[model samples]
Target: MLIAQITDTHIKLPGKLAYKKVDTAAMLKRCVDELLTLDPQPDLILLTGDLVDLGRPAEYDHLKSILAPIRQRIIAIPGNHDDREAMRGAFHAEGYLPTEGKFLQFVVEDYPLRIVGLDTLIPGEGGGELCAERLEWLDRTLAQKPDVPTLVLMHHPPFITGIGHMDKIGLKGSDGFAAVMERHRHVELILCGHLHRTIHAQVGGRPAMTCPSPAHQVALDIDPEAPSCFTMEPPGFMLHWWNGRRLVTHTAVIGSYDGPHPFFDANGKLID
Candidate 1:
């Protein structure tokens, strides 16, 4: 099965751009157009977090309109920029998010890969944390179906990315999270967003990765005191393919570019 991962969309009001720079709305529309063109369309679409620039209801409305073209089911978690209650109300009809929980966490057992979405939003804080309650819930949930290959979705990546500024706002309680993963070997991958760029790491012996944004990417500066900034880098998303055994990921960059030149001639001879 193929799953498409789009994160950090940060959709704003209809006429606004993100940070007065990136045109997040337009970029997301382009990304959606690209997703619609995939040959074997993704079976599911996972929105890691930051669906809007702010947690406003109108922003959510705008986001919904932009993503209306997608027919596949979308599973989303909350990011630092998201408001839990706003998001819950916005997507309540979907029924994945719990009706009474303080967190927007949920599980999907309908597919071969069991999906476990974690809520890491810390309200007004720019950083995130998975407190003991959430950690225990994850442990208990994974214990329920030990045999099923699972995927954990959250907004903040657990590992410390070398990008200093971003790392400063990274997930707290990562050590505890790693410990939980150590006990659940069946967990296939941990999908996260918030970094706004492609990054990979291993936590508690499990693979974890962050997807790129559909608009701007966090500037790649790996210093202890890197400045906080973003760049108009090649926007992109990710495709995770589960071929019955393992999960493989590919970065799908957005926008138009060069041709699909062949390495060989029509007669099968190498082109010089």
Candidate 2:
């Protein structure tokens, strides 16, 4: 099974620019088009968070239109920039996001791997947190499906990225979360977003990664005092392919680029 991951779109209403510069909607369109071009379309699309800039209903409407091209099943979680209620209403068609819950968490079991989404958003705040109740829920849920290969999804990364500005607003309660993760060996991958770059790390000895956005990216600033800033870096997404036993991830960049160069020049022999 193959799954595509796109995150931190930050799509605004029509004709609006994210951070007064990037055209996130257009970028998202390019990403959709690119996804459609794959040899076999992805079985599912995992949108990690920050789907919109201001958590507006209008933006969600536009977001729906932007993502309407791909026919694959989609699962999304909320980020700090998102409004849970509005997201619930926007994606009500999926019927997976719980309405009466304190956190928007769920497990999808229709595919080869079990998909678990953990909502780490804190309304009106940039930082993320996993409360005790939510942690308990995760522990219980993972315990219930110990034999199944699982993919844990969330909007906020549980580890700090050293990017000074973003770290201040990074996920809280990571140590506790890690403790819970250590007990769950079924977790194949812990996926996340919010940093807008391809970040790789290990959480509780399990591989974790943050997918890049379809638009702009946060500057790779390692300075301990760097201010909050973004960059016009090449945008991209992630493709997670489950080859029966293990998962392999490939990062896909947006836009038209060099040709799919031929390995052999009209011959089966080595090109060299």
lDDT of every model, 2 decimals: 0.95, 0.93
Give the local distance difference test score of model 1.
0.95
lDDT of 2 by residue, 226-254 (tens): 89999988999999999989999999999
Off-target runs (Cα >4 Å) in candidate 2 are 268-272
* TM-score computed on alpha carbons, candidate 2: 0.97
**Each prediction's TM-score versus the true structure:** 0.99, 0.97
- State the RMSD for candidate 2: 1.1
What is the number of residue pairs that collide in model 2?
A: 0
lDDT of 1 at 45: 98
Model 1 clash tally? 0
